[model samples]
Target: MSVASMLKNNKLSKAICEASWATFKAMIAYKAKWYGKQLVVVAKNFPSSQLCSHCGYQNKDVKHLTLREWQCPNCHTRHDRDVNASINIKNEAVWLLTAGTAGLAY
Candidate 1:
């Protein structure tokens, strides 16, 4: 087998991630359209990283994508690659929706 084909066959992680992410986002978008629900894409600059998942502490250091794992200097809490960021983003979305401020915030 050629190297290119070998790489394609062995790249399970990337393929799986791409497939799932695409499907999930598409499902949400299509369903929202079908139901006339508002679907907001939180602005790319919405600070998904700098906000601490645990304390809501905003710091500039957290935005560095190179640091997949890092310690929140303020709280001395270590976080996994995307876990803290995902949690913080989800919480923020819920908060904005529940607070009836999603229209103005996103």
Candidate 2:
């Protein structure tokens, strides 16, 4: 998670500060290194929550946290907010891995 970006919101700033995201990320990095795995860090501002995983449509209306469910206008696919975001994150990581090292070995 991007602590800085999250901290920008007044509602989440305190909770974000208390979450120790830096420590969590450090642990993840350490584990990845120990396991000989490459860690792909996506951009902090990537709109995972707003993007439709099935159709790549950006639903700007889903910006509010209260909207836990949404439908993609482009593909008309119903989506659970968190599920869609996780899928987008996974897709982005896979894309980054392939595009960043197209000719290189893992």
Candidate 3:
């Protein structure tokens, strides 16, 4: 459902809507530093959800949040949307790390 719909239906609250993502990121950064690890922030518009983790095929048609599961047309692989997104994000991070460009802020 849309954020506006959720807010109207009381499924989402105003405080949550006004929360600062930067504060959350700062908290994660501090925690990661304390643990002697790095925190990587991906670009805001990265298409993690639309990418096929198995074959690196990007399905531009998967733009709606309602699509919770989909099949990769390229590889014919069935995927849970969230699981595929997580894998794609992880792979992207790893690629950035290996390519020696992870430190460059987006």
Candidate 4:
């Protein structure tokens, strides 16, 4: 979740502000550089949660945040929203790195 959105929630606003996302990202970049590794940031418009990791099918209905679990219409594979998004992110990162367009190679 983006810090801005998290801060919109009254219960989470304080904790979100305390996290200091800018510093966190800086730290991550520093660590990636120190370890000679690349960091990939998927495009903000990428529909990670809506895409089925198993079949590459985009389910527009999954855009509803309340829908946590869904089945791929093309492949009939069940998925947990967050888990599928993570897999999609990893795949996209690898693809970007291999395509010589790493998002943020530190």
lDDT of each: 0.72, 0.86, 0.81, 0.89
lDDT per residue for candidate 2 within 1-106, as digits (tens), equals 6768889999999887767876787788788788998778877798999999988999999999999999999999999999999999889889988887422122
TM-score to true structure, per model: 0.59, 0.77, 0.79, 0.78
- The weakest ten consecutive residues by lDDT in model 4 span 14-23
lDDT of 1 by residue, 1-106 (tens): 6545654775665776678777887888788888877665555577777777777777687667887887777787788748987887778778877887774311
Q: TM-score of predicted model 3?
A: 0.79
lDDT of 3: 0.81
RMSD of each: 6.6, 6.5, 5.2, 5.1
Q: Please give the ranking of all candidate structures by lDDT, highest first, separated by commas.
A: 4, 2, 3, 1
Q: Count clashes in each candidate, considering only residues at least 3 apart in sequence or on different chains.
A: 0, 0, 0, 0
Q: Please identify model 4 stretches exceeding 4 Å from their true place.
A: 1-19
lDDT of each residue in 1-106, candidate 3, tens digit only: 6666766855456655656566677778888888888777677788999999989899987888999999989999998889999998888888888887785322
Please say which candidate is ahead in TM-score: 2 or 4.
4
Error of 2 at 56 (Å): 0.4
Clashing pairs in 4: none
Candidate 3: count of backbone clashes, pairs at least 3 residues apart or interchain: 0
Considering TM-score, where higher is better, how would the candidates rank from best to worst? 3, 4, 2, 1
